[model samples]
Structures are given as C-alpha cells and as structure tokens.
Target: MGFQEFLGNERIVTALRGALRTKRVPHALLFTGARGVGKFTLARMFAQAANCERLPDDFCGECATCQRISQLADPQTLLEQGLAERGESADAATVERVPLILQSHPDVWALVPDPVRLKSPVARPMLRVGQLRAVQRAAYFQPMGRRRVFILDGAETMRWDVANVFLKILEEPPGSATLILTAPSPYALLPTIVSRCLQFHFAPLPQAAVEKILKEKTDRKPTEIKLAAQLAEGSPGLAIEMDVEAAAQRRRSALRILERAAQGHGFAQLFSDTSALAKDRDSSFEHQIGVFYGLLTDLLELTSKVKEPVLRNAPLAKELESLAKSVDSAWVLRAIAGFDELYVGARRNLNRQLGLDALAASLAPAPSRASVTHS
Candidate 1:
C-alpha cells in the first residue's frame, strides 16, 4: 500500500518521491496513462507524501496526522494541515490505500459513459456535461481533505462541454486542489487542457510485471495466468480485471486451442470454442471477446518471437510460416487482412461469435481458403 508496494512505473515513483523530498511539488499534476497503470494510486500517494508529519524520508503511518489522513477521518482536513501535521513527507503507503477505494469515493469523480456502451450500437461512451459541472462545484468548495484531488478516470469520454469546463480550472486551479486525470491517449484530450497541467505520461507495464500480478492475484493455474499475462499486452489492469473463474476458463479454452494448433489441431474444437464464446450473451460476452482477442495475441507473439504481443492473429501463425515458406508473403498478408477486418467488424456491430467462427474456419487446416507453401 505504499510506493514500494506499487507494482509498476518505478520512474514515476522516483520522480514524485524526489519532489516530495524537496517540498517543491507542483499544485496541478495530471497522471495520464492507460487504465489500471497506477496513476491514481500514485496521485493519492503523492498527496499523502506532500504533507506527512513523519521524518524526512517518508510519512510515518503511525502519526496522528497520518492516521487521520489515511482513514479520511477528518472532515475539515486542509492541505496545509495535512502537510503541517506530518513528517516532512507524507506516507506513500497511506495515500496508495486511498486510491484502492477511489472508484467508489464520493469525492473522487468520473464522467465516462458506460462501458456497456461498447456492446451498444454506437460502441462509445459519452461523458455528459453534468460531470463537468460537478467539477465546477467541487472547485468552489475548500479542500475536503488535505487536498481535494479530482481524478477523472476516463478523460477520453469528456464531451466538448466537459473539456471546456476544464479549461478554467486547469488554467487557475485552487491552491489546495489537484487533478489526477487518466486517459488511454492524450490525443483524445483537448490540447488546451493538455497545455494546462503538469502532464505525467504513464507507459505500459512490463510483461513480467503483468504476469507476476496475475499469478499472485488469481487462483488460476500458473499456465493459465501466464497465458493471460502474455496476451494482456503488458496491461496488469487487464490481467487483474478478470474474474478468477472466467479468466481461468478463458485461459483453459485458449490453451486448448494453442495445444491443438501445436499438434496440427483439428477444426471442430476451434469452431466449438468460437461458438461457445459467442453464446455468452450477457456480461460474459465482453470477457469472452477480450479473452479471445488476448488468446490470438498470445499465439501471434509466439510466432514471431516478437517481444510485444500486439498481434492477435497468432493462431494463424503456423499457417503463416507454412505459406510464407511455400508461396509469396501475399497469402499470409491476405489472411492478416481478413482477420484485421474481422476484428474491426466485431468491435463495431458484427456478431462476435460469427466473426470468430469465420476466422476459425478460415484458419482450419483442411479446405482452408489459403494453400500452404512447401519449403
């Protein structure tokens, strides 16, 4: 629950830690990164570190100030009080604990449209104008805690009005207030808003880090966790996000596919897997799709020995190599084209199961549209 406990982003930890040591931390900091990359966690830690009453090195968790701040016990908590009551630096452990509750925190707000919208016709979430209005109201209030940190979880959902509401605050934010905003990409944010805050870019975590967390957090077999981690594209958030059972099942299914493919697997099993995934009509559908995508990505990574797992076309790798050796790269290229389009179609409105079925059928060893090349 401290900086030491933070799973990834060591450089970020070091920078904030350094700033706290010098007591020259900026008032307006924006933590931008993919979801679940520890931006929010770091923000809360930084908040506590700025005002701990402990020794110079860090916040003493046992201090009266630390106790009050850590538990959010004080209603009248002000930034100066938080800073004054603690050690020269606040306890990172205590602050990190706060973010664990951030999703449900009343004061901590998000304006994103529903994720289920991806399942909707539009496939997009809209951050309404009201969310921005709340930010205005929060800004008008004095510090709720030692600092009133406004963490916009899905900043990309910000509508034009929402982004505009931020312009004023970002330009002249309250002295005691801090904004720890997160988004998948800054390109989605307004350049004006981007210009205002001290932006902290968070890159993806290492695959090893993702694997470690997945293994530790899930009761799934080590093999299953490793598969998910590999396919997760270094996103620990994605790995931790799986419900243990669903994640386990997905891993099992994917491994079965890989095991079969390794052995020049039959087509019926792939068809069955695709059909089964498509049958999940409720919440599990998204998980199934994500798992399927991750599964393909793992196979793709295995094919090229490419360190990054961005390719979800991996299930087709064996065929790719065969075709590449026998024919020109054209056939492999077409296979990729077909799947990429299929992925896009699934992402939009096409039936996911059908897409997977089509993909599976195409990749099948027998009667495939693709003819393998003999080396």
Candidate 2:
C-alpha cells in the first residue's frame, strides 16, 4: 500500500514523508500504536519508498525492488533456493513452506518469534535469541540493492536476552539498512530498546475513519458498520471484528437482568445472566463483565434522557426505552455503580462469582416490610 492509499494519521505521514524528502531517514524507527491501526502497513510503505530504485520519495510501486520488498519475497526465495539445492521433492517442499509471510520486501527482512517456542502457549510469546542473532548476522552483510530494511512485526515480544542481543545493532545499525519495529505501545518494549529508535506514535482512527475503512474493506451492512464504528473505540480492526447481532444480544440480556432486579427477583436471574463470567482464570470472564458494564452504562444513559439516547446497541432501542420508563435515573445509577465494582474486581483477579453476587445484591430492591396492625 502506498502512502496515498493509507488513511488517517496525517501528522505521522507528513513527518515520514519529510524524512524521505530530506534523505535523513532514521536507521532505527519505532511505530507504536493500537493493533490494526496501520503501523505495519505504513512501515512497509516507508521501506519500499526508501529503497525504490526509480523514486525514493513517492515510491514507484511497480519497480522490481518495490514489488519484492512489498511481497517480502527475499526470505521466501532464499528458502525455496535452499530446498531446491537439497533436491527436495514437491511433497516435502510443500511441508517446508513458511506459514507467516503475508508479504515483505526483498531488501526488507522480517523477524518474528519462532513458532516452536510459541507452541507451548503464553500470555505473550517470546521472540527467541536465535531470531535476533539471525538479524544480527544479516545486519553486517552488504545489501543486494541500494538499501536494506529490517522489519520486526511484534518487536515487544522479544525476550530479555533477545532484546539485549539486538541492542548494539539497533544503536549503530549496519550498511545501508533501516530497521523498523511495530508494537502495540512503546511502553511494552524495554526502555533501552525504545530509547534507540526514532518513535512515531500512531493514534486510533476516529469513528468516521473507522467506518470508512469498514465500508471499503468489508461487505458489512450499514447498521452493522454504524454500530461497530461506535463500539470500536476508534480501532478499525476491532470495528471489522465486531458482530452487531452478538452485541445486541448482550444488550437484551443486560436489560433482562435489570428488569429481574427491579422486580425484586434477587440473585437467581442476575446470577444466571452472569453464569458465563464465573471463571477466575479466563479472560472471557473479563469480557463478559465488560458486556454487562456496557449494558449498565447504556441503561444509565437511556434512563437519564426522557427519550432514547444515541446507542451502539441501537437494535435494542425499544427494550432500552421500556427499561428507562420503568426505572428512575437513581436506580439506573446504582446498577451502573454495581457493574463498576464487578469490572474493577474482574481486572484485579477477584472471585468472579462472588463479585457478580455482590453486584446483584446491591442492585436488588430492598425487601418489602409487612405492616404491623395494632388491635
């Protein structure tokens, strides 16, 4: 993708273009932002622009060098040649194929964690020292072209030893090479690693921008696009993944829970509502809690207004209106507060069921006292 096709982050784009125009591109650059916000895409364009044989400023996308870099063909060609040299058969060659190459430049070396180390599973996968060493070895080599670029996609995943191994190369990068690192945030990386690079902060796209990307990239319906754009918190990637039906279902479930509580049904119905959130060790439990929190926030917003409020869960407008009519803002506020506790507790790794029970208890209306007659 050229800079022309890339959307949003105008300031970052301008700065990068300025670097290219001046022939003062940094040897090491860090692109940090939320996932799916085009950091990796922009990095690829920058690399292609830097090494383009014909035009370095605007990047002639048709050149052999640009095509190879954009396709990440160097490593693939190297692997295929090595296989051919060993006289591997077709069947074996199929098995030996690299799984993760979406694309890269021939002059652009892409580094990621070795899958063997990642097979065991972890919250964060470790980028092994071997990968860094390979990069280090390649660092000293003369480029096959005018400029060489190394792209580390999940730079934050580098283990302590792995990060340490690359520190020297990062500080004083070798011949005609530019290194680019992409991560969710610079804070996720080591201070030493962060300090060595020229950092570009990628901001989340605005709702309209996210919606535009969704419209262009997917066949999602208008309503789904609208709801997802509102719910995505400015991440186009998240917006594309959001399912409108599922979110509406959660909204309905939340309204049902509120209705049961207001009817003085106590913990039974609300407990059932949160049955999916009983796990202390699972992240899904946290997500379920968040869904409930979104519901309460919707209720609070709906009830505060005499009419319907603008809703991400717009499909649940009728149910929201009904709930708003029945419950006062004070009651809805209390329910919202209850969910706040559950959300906080879930994050802190407190007992999920206990938190849900406490939340339900707080929201359940006080028991009615029978009148005592004096004879």
Candidate 3:
C-alpha cells in the first residue's frame, strides 16, 4: 500500500515523504515505538518508495517492484506458510526448529528473531550474529532495485554480540543499501547504534483512530471491535491482531483475582482461583499478566479519581469503580507494581502458579484495625 493508506503517525509519514522528495534518504533509520504502532509498515512502504519503478518520490503500489516488496511476511506467518506448502503440521517441535528470514523481493529482506539455538523450545528468539552476517554479505552486492532495503523487526532482541555485528554494518553501511530497525524504545537498543541512525518515534494512535482502523480491517462484531480498540491502548496493529474472546476471558479472570483480593480473601481461595486461571492455555501467560496489569491500571485510575479516565476495560467500568471504592489508592499502586514484576517474570518462563500466588499475596489488603485489635 502507498503511504496514504497508512493511518496515524502523520508526522512520520511527512518525514518519510520529505526524505523521498529530497532524494536524501538516510542509510539507516531507527523507528522506536511500542509494538504494532506502524514502524514495520512504514519501513515496508519506505522500501517500496525507494525502489518503485513507477514513481520517483512515492509508491504507486501497483508496479511489479512495489507488489513484490509488499509480499513480505512476519516470521510466524512465513513459517506457517512454508509448513502448509510442505503439507506438514506446524507442531511445536517443527516450529522451534525453523530459523526464518522472510524475503519477498530479492532487494528487500525482513529479518525477525529466530531461535538462537535451534530445537530448544525454551531458547529465546533473537537476531543472532549469523543473521546479521548474512545481511552484511548481502549488503555489498548491487541490488536489482534502486536500493537494497533491510528491515530488522524487533531489533532489541539482539544480544550485545549480535548488536556489535550490526554496529559494524552501521559504521560502514553500503552505498546502495538502507537499513531500518524497529524497537519498542531507543533505550532498549545500544547507544552507539542509536547515535548512528536517523531516529523517529512513533506515537500510539488515538482510541478513535484505532477503532476506525479496526472497522476498516477486521470483520469482528461492533462490540468486539469497540472492546479491542479500548484494550489495545492505542496500537491499531494490536487491536487488529488481538483475539477478542480470549482477551475478554483473561479480563474476567483477572477481575476475579482483583475482586477476591479486594474482599480480603484467604490465601487458599486466591491460590485456587489463580491456579484455575493459569491452567487455561487459551492465551499466553504473558498476555494474561498484561490483562491483569491493564485492570490494575484501570483500578488505579478509578481510585485516584481521575476525571473521565479512559479505561482499557471500559465494559467493566462500573464494576471497577465499585471495586475501587473497596480498596485504597495505596494498595492499587502496590498491586500495579507487583504485576509489573510478574509481567517481566512471565516473560522469563517463571512458574505461573507461584508467581500468581506471590502476586495475590502482595495484593492482599492489610488487616482492619478492629480485627487486629480483637486478635
């Protein structure tokens, strides 16, 4: 699609178009923002604009070159497509074994995190040195198009050694190539790397903007669309990709825990509820933790008496408001902090039950003065 098709981030679009108009495209670009804002989409469009045969400063989006570049897919999609082509099941074992770099056009490379060590389910996916080395070698060649574009998705996944390899490329970039790196924030990357590239920060889209985009892109129910839009926290990409039913379920489960804790439930009851929630494999534990965090944030907002506070779980606003009254701002703030730690721990494959237990314990309200005095 052309740049006009990309919604939100008008400033970034203008800057990219200006770069094209002046024919002064930087050799490297760093797009920093939260996940699913539009960094990767913009990167793809920029690559097309740089190489589109039909336009000098913009993409027609119909030319052979532009169409080919648009075929780029994320790693999971690429892997699934490959497996489907082979008539093989995309089982966990099979998925863990594949290392992927999706290239739809010879001149366009889309790099994502692959398992650093193959055949190991626990091995974190990263942009390893080997992948950067391949890009390094490819960078020296003349491209079939005007520019060879490399889009490094999730660039923060690179460890120091791998980042060092990429640093060399940035230090001496090829004349005919442009490198694009996308990360959640610039601080997540190396200072040296951040200093080398032209940086752009992508802001989250407004909820209305996100809702409009969701209507355009997805066929989910209007209610689901509205909920997804609210829960996405301004990322249209996230709203588009979110599993609405699963999100709702997660929110319900998270709210149950909050309710129990607010009512000063005992450890056994809290642990039992947490165990049931953790056992549901419908969604990732990390995602479950994220939902809990969102609920906690909403509770914090309600407890703090924010004027017209926008909530991620708007459907439960009344319930959250009622719950907010049962707890003080101090406990909600502390619970939010606990969930932040739990979210990070979830990413590290922490024991879900144990972590949830600890979180529930932390969320336990202090004893009432009457009870303490009676005891």
In terms of lDDT, the best-performing candidate is 3
Each candidate: what lDDT?
0.55, 0.68, 0.80
lDDT of 1 by residue, 228-290 (tens): 665556677666665545555555665565444333345566667667666755434434544
Q: What TM-score, computed on C-alpha atoms, does each candidate reach?
A: 0.57, 0.63, 0.81
CA lDDT, candidate 3, residue 109 = 88
**For model 1, what is the error of residue 291's alpha carbon versus the real structure, in angstroms, after optimal superposition?**
8.2
lDDT of 2 at 96: 28
Candidate 2 RMSD computed on C-alpha atoms after optimal superposition onto the true structure: 8.5
User: What would the C-alpha RMSD of candidate 3 be, to one decimal place?
Assistant: 4.6
lDDT of 2: 0.68
Deviation from truth (RMSD, Å), model 1: 10.9
The digit string of per-residue lDDT tens for model 3 on 1-375 reads 578888899998899889888878898999998678888988988989999998877899899999888776344666445435533434454443443567888999888876433334345566766678788888889999898999999898788666988898899989989999998778668899999999999987888899999999888899888889887877898888898777777788789889988777555677888998788866656557667877888988888889999887888888898898899889988888887777666655688788887777767666631232211
- List residue ranges in candidate 3 displaced over 4 A: 73-77, 81-99, 115-125, 185-198, 276-280, 347-352, 367-375
Residue 72's lDDT within candidate 2 is 53
